[model samples]
Target: MGGQENVDYSIVICTYNPDENVLKRCLQAVRQLNVANISTEVILVDNNSKVRVQDLPYIKEYTAGIPGLKQLFVVKQGLLYARLAAIAEAKGAQIVFFDDDNEPESEYLQELHRLNKQFPNVAAWGPGNVEVDFVDGVDDNIREVALQLFQHRTATTVGFAAIKDWQPCYPYGTGLCIKTDLCREYLQQVNQGRLTLTGRNGNKLSSGEDTQMIMLCISKGYAAGISPALRLTHIITAKRANRPYMNRLLYGTRSCYETCMVQVFPERKQMLESKLISGAKFSRQTLKKFLKTKWNRSPQKTFDLIQFIAAHASDYMALDKPLPGFVNKVLTSLKIV
Candidate 1:
């Protein structure tokens, strides 16, 4: 199915087993969007949640008054599949992604319309002010680290251009806006089994689908960016505010980083695979940073750095063989696969 004629934007919300309160807030934010005279649609792609659609009565209440609202029940388990379903059913020239925890400002759609006009060539962009709202208070150390790591406030400038390989400015999943035509292009690659990042399937936090899509757009001579003008609040539950969960999320994202890069930019496979250091030197460097951070009482930063080093080490070790195989071996050893 292709996009419908004269539709401006399709806001897609993909959820599996979301907290009802959080989901309600997310829907309410969408409902409260100030679209003015713009034609829009709301698509809810339920990714096989335990709660049936018939049981989700509040969903209807929150989605009311949207121009074209459709709730789809997708049996596929992963975030990738759920989003794929939305792309097929979307009837808008532009598509915006909203996680179940994202709460957009009332002017989100209006700001997005302005951004589209400003950056006409940029295929993908997202909100830079991704503030985190913790339901339960967190410890000082964890709170500090979480805000720095989880928030997406890194865009110091507002411009669209080809992002370098090492630059960590790719628009994240929250509030990700992309052209519908680019989404159709991505859909073909995903359907052919070329892109495999499932992105937070159930409790498993492995992610990269968002980055993969942006990379695809970049590969096709398009730009991606982030703007502070657009804003959204990420609601973090108590379960995700602890040290253990934080470490897991960090590890999951880091583990999939290299694989996603290789998969998306196969032409640069050799260049990436060649940029590895010896295990002994890498270990010494990692140990030095670890001890220094430990002495400084920054365990979270230490763990975060270790994950990046481990990812590089995995690439270095797998230099002789296929990249994905070596990464998967490391994941299996760590029981992440």
Candidate 2:
């Protein structure tokens, strides 16, 4: 039902409003894959992009001559929806998810194939070394935060453990490889509206769809882990690495903490509820730190701290309004709105 259909690996790249040059670089890297003798396929899922990927002048130039198979699908939705679309079309045993900006190493497929064989029980595998390259060159001010912002991982290891204990070791959306059947199972839940997290949708930066999928696999007794052998480079545009963009990303991350906790770790619902109930006090303490960061002119850290305060304070204060209420207040006070 899977690889028996002739596709052994399905490389899925999901993109939305991607820069033409960046997309070309990503495709160029894909065209350079050392696929050996294994049958492979590349599926590009354009997530409701303003510009159709196929219409791009340089798209065919980069995607041309890429071994086994190539496909393009327009999901016209968020990241998860686009991924689900790719899953529906993928005929390979393993479905590797790549962002439009991700450039995989030449041996990426070979390494992933080896890991799949070595750890058959591990349902999902992540790249161990996810290096970041800024298109406009690295800025000294944002250099440190940029690495964290882009989810760069330098740790090298090959092990499958509990998803919770793995920390940042678990697979992220970039260069994430999962079984086709598992992806198909997830697609069914998403289609049935059982899954609530929609990943990032246009202006909305909320995420954790990848974690949700990994958790689902774990719940079904399949493990998730990282392999040092798998590697990829995440190309960051200058516009995306700035304070404003990072602020939105951090805010999205903090706002979705409760959702991720509730959906991925349902057993900890009581703990999360208790924490949120006392969030007013936590918010006060966090506000003090936020003020200190503001004074220190650390926008990245300030937003990171404040978003947590905003998420929990809204819950504790029993605000009928959205989390933005807290955000608006803080932003007004900081004069950043």
- Tens digits of per-residue lDDT, candidate 1, 124-239, equal 88887788888777778777777755764645557566764634555888899999998998888888988777777766775678878888888888888888778899988887
Clashes of each: 0, 0
Please give the lDDT score at residue 320 for candidate 1.
Answer: 38
List RMSD in Å for every model shown: 3.4, 3.1
User: For candidate 2, what is the lDDT?
Assistant: 0.75
Which stretches of model 2 miss by more than 4 angstroms?
A: 1-4, 164-166, 277-279, 300-304, 310-328, 331-337
Candidate with best lDDT:
1
Candidate 2 clashing pairs, residues 3+ apart or interchain: none
Per-model TM against the reference: 0.87, 0.89
For model 1, give the 10-residue run with minimal summed lDDT.
317-326
Q: Residue by residue across 1-337, what tens digits does model 2's lDDT show?
A: 2333877899888888789888888999998999887788888887777778778788778888976545556656788778877788888998899899999999999988888887889999988888999888766787777787687888756767765523566777789998888888887877787667778876667566877788778877888988888889999988888876776666665566556546555676666556554435564666677678858886556765656664774343332224334445775564433
The TM-score between candidate 2 and the true structure equals 0.89
